[model samples]
Structures are given as structure tokens and as C-alpha cells.
Target: MSSTETATLSVPGANLSYTVRGSGPVLLLIHGGNGDANVYAGIAEHLAERYTVVTYDRRGYSRSKLDNAAKEYSLETHSEDIHRLLTELTCEPAYVFGSSAGAIIGLELACHYPGQIHTLIAHEPPLTHLLSGDEQVHARHIQENLEITAQREGIVPAIRQFATLLGLDQSNGSSGRPNVEQLERLLANMNYFVMREAPAIRRHTLDLETLKTVWNGASMRIVIGGGRASYGTFPYQCAVALARQLGLEIVEFPGNHLGYVHQSQEFAMRLHIALQD
Candidate 1:
């Protein structure tokens, strides 16, 4: 196994903690939901064998300490942090993989700072802005309900509701044991995610015009991806909608939303194939 090197960057409102391993073109992994850099540990380890895998805890999550805990989280700030990290870490443009909310952030980065990215694989970005009429209203209601639940009940119940809304709580009878440490870390970050990140994500609107400009110019290659089993879910639908709008192909990965966690090696292999020369 390649040794992991940890570092910190003093960004605007937070000191970001990140990890780097292996060596090749820089491939930065942006985690989603109640997660930190550790969420990509398995995928990073596999990808590191061929590429320099970089993973970081977004502002106010895990090891990334925030200067203002009460500061409202926004997609702009999240995207800016990624741009700063890439600019400080590499002279050349980097490949980026962003999951869920992280995927939304990647889209923002590609739209605003096209020069900083080579290719971006945005996996299941929950782009509610792409929806229309009834679907949009339905999505809004779900998010609003989640916020209310978190405020009234707590993070755990809110998360359970979230999973149920996405239909992820259904039993598949898979026998793998959960990682206790990862679960604890995820639980610890739930407060930040539920109170701040989720709201930010819900309010964000992707600039389709800017995205079209970048894609038309071929300045940045954007690939939409989703889990095969996650079809019909909001995130999967969002990926499909975005791909349809952009006239791009939607790449299917191994498992559901958390595929990279349980099927990391398989996901890594498919990811490498999708990113091949």
C-alpha cells in the first residue's frame, strides 16, 4: 500500500485537511453527504496504484476546522475551496470525481473555473433545478420535510428519513458488515450536513448556459454517472436530466448511492475504464 501524506490548507473560512497518495496525474476525489476524506479511502487506495489520488474533508467536516461555525454553507464556497486546493497542489489541470453533493460542487467548479479541470466525472449530483413543475415541487417538499425532521427529531432520525425518501432503506439482504469507524465519522458529521450542507445543496441552481458554453467549446469534458440500482431516485433522475440537457451519455456504476463504499474495487475498475485514454 502506498503511504498517505496528510496536509492542511488555510482557505477562506476553514483550514482544510487533505490526503495524497501514489503518483501520476492528480485525481481529486470529492466526498458527499455526512462524509470526509476518509469516505474515499478504499477507492483512493485502488486509484492510487495508477494515479495521484487526493481526497479532502470539505469545510466544517471532520478534520477541516471552520473559523465560523455559524457561517452559512454555499455551493460557491465549496467550489472555490476545490479550485484553491487544485491551484495550490498542481500546476496542471486535474481530474475530479464528485459524488452526490460533491458532484454538484464539481459542476459549479467546471462552470466557473473551467481551466482548472481536465475531465470531471460527476456521479449522481442532486440537481433539483433541472426538474420542472410537479417534480420540482415534490423534491422541495422532501427536502423541507428532511430539514424539519432534523430540527425536531435529530440527525439520526433525519438520516433515516432521508434514506427512506430515496428508497435506500429497503433491505437487499447483502451480508457485508458495516464499518464501525466510518459509521461513527458519518454520524459525527451528520449535524453539519443536515443543518448546513443539505440546505445549501437544496438551494443551489446550476448555470446551464455556462455549462453549455464549456461543453460546446470542449474546454472541459464532463461525464454524468449514476448507480445502476439507483434508477428512479432523485439523484439518478438528476443525472439523467443533466445528461439529456447536455446530450451526454450517462455512465452506470456498480451499486447504489454508496457503491464506492461497499464495492470500492469494482467501482474503481469501472471508473478507470470510463476515464481511459
Candidate 2:
């Protein structure tokens, strides 16, 4: 097994905590809401065999500290953070895998810095903006109701609903045993994710024209990934819409929305194949 090394990068408004394992070309893993660098621990070991797998805590998540306690989160800000991380770590274009809100951030990063990314496998980005008419309205309505749940009912009930929204099966949950410490941290992040991160994701709009131009050329290969078990879910539907808009096929992975956690080994294998192709 490759020895994991921990590090930090100083970025605008925050000091990002990151990890690197194995060697070769860089492969950065960006986590979704309430997830930190450690979220990718299971799959990073497998991927590390072929690539220098990098994972980081997005600002205000865990070890990553925000300069301002109340710093506003946005896709553009998160994207810029990733750009800086890649720029600091590698001179060559790097491979990026971002799931959920992280995927949305990846799209924003690719849009702004096409030269910094080799290939981006965006898994289940909740691009409500891409949905048409009623679909868009419905998705936003669900999100709004979720906020109300979080505010009135509390984070626990809201999280359960959030899980349902992502098409996750509570019974199956994670493939590996849950870590008590990690679960506590996730619980702690719940309020922030609901009050801040979720809203930021909703407000984000991708530059479709720029993305189309980049996908048309060879500067960067953008692949949309959706979990087989997450079919018909809002995020999966959003992924399908994205692939259609880009004229690319949506690659199916194992498990549901939290596939990387529940189906780490299989998800890693699928991701490796996608990156290779």
C-alpha cells in the first residue's frame, strides 16, 4: 500500500487540507456536501496504484479552515480553490473526479481553466439549471421544501429527506463500517451544508457555451457519470441532461448517489475505465 501524505494549501479565504497517495499523474478527488478529504479513503488506495490520488476537504468542511467564519460559499469560489490546488501541485493538466456538488464545482473549474484539466468525470452533479421547465421548477421546489424541513423539523429529518432526494437506500448505507468520528463530523456539518452549501449549489449556473466549446475540442474531455441505482433521481436526471447537452454518453457506475462510499472498489474500477477511455 502506498503511504498517505497529508498537506495543506493556502488559498484565498481558506487554508485547504489535502491528502496525496501513490505516484504518477495526479488524480484529484473532490467530495460533495458534508464530505471531507477522508471521504475518499476507501477508493483512493486502489486508485493510488496507478495515479497520485489527491483528495481535499472543501472549505469549511473539516480540516480546511475558512479565514472568515461566515465566508459565503459558491461554485465559483470552490472551483477557484481547485484551480489553485492543481496549479500549486502540477504543471501538467490533471484528472479530476467530482461527485454531487463537487461535480458542479468541477464543471465550474473546467469552464474557467480548461488548460488545467485533462479529463473531468463529473458524477451526479445537481445541475437543476439544466432541467427544462417543469422539471426545473419541481427540482427547485424539492430543494426549497428540504430547506424548510431543515429549518422547521431539524437537520436529522432533513438529512433523511436529502438522502431520499439523492436516491440512496438507507438500509444499504455504506459498504464499510461507519467511523464514529467521521459520523460526528458529518453531523456537525449538517447545519452548514443545509444552510450554506446547499443554497450555494442551487444558485450556481454553469457556463454552457464555454463548456460546449471545450467539449467540442480536445482541450479537455468531459464525461458525465451517473450511478445505475440512482436512475430517475433528480441528480441522475441532471447528469443525463448534461450528457445530452454535451453530446456525450453518461457512464453508469455501481450503487446509488453515494456510490463512491458504498461501492468504493467498484466505483474506483469504473472511474479508472472512464479515465482510460
For candidate 2, write residues 1-277 as lDDT tens digits: 9988999999989999999999999999999884677768888999999999999999888788789978666778989999999998999999999999889999998888888899999999999999998888978987887789999999879978877776676532334666897677777667778888888788778889997777666578889999999887888989999999888899999988888887789989999999999
Off by over 4 Å in 1: 169-185
Residue 70 alpha-carbon offset, candidate 1, angstroms: 1.3
Note the residue pairs that clash in candidate 1.
none
Q: How accurate is candidate 2 locally (lDDT)?
A: 0.87
Q: Write the per-residue lDDT of candidate 1 for residues 1-277, one digit (tens) a residue.
A: 9988999999999999999999999999998984678768888999999999999999888789889998777888999999999998998988999999999999999988888888899999998889887777887888888899988999889888888888674322223654786556666688888888888888888999988897677666889999998987878888988999999889999888878877889999988887773
| lDDT of every model, 2 decimals | 0.86, 0.87
Give the TM-scores of the predictions, in the order they appear: 0.92, 0.93
Which portions of model 2 miss their true places by more than 4 Å?
Answer: 170-184
Task: Give the range of the ten consecutive residues with the poorest summed lDDT in model 2.
Answer: 166-175
lDDT score, candidate 1, position 275: 77
Each candidate structure's count of clashing pairs: 0, 0
Q: Which candidate has the top score in TM-score? A: 2
Task: In model 2, state the lDDT of residue 142.
Answer: 78
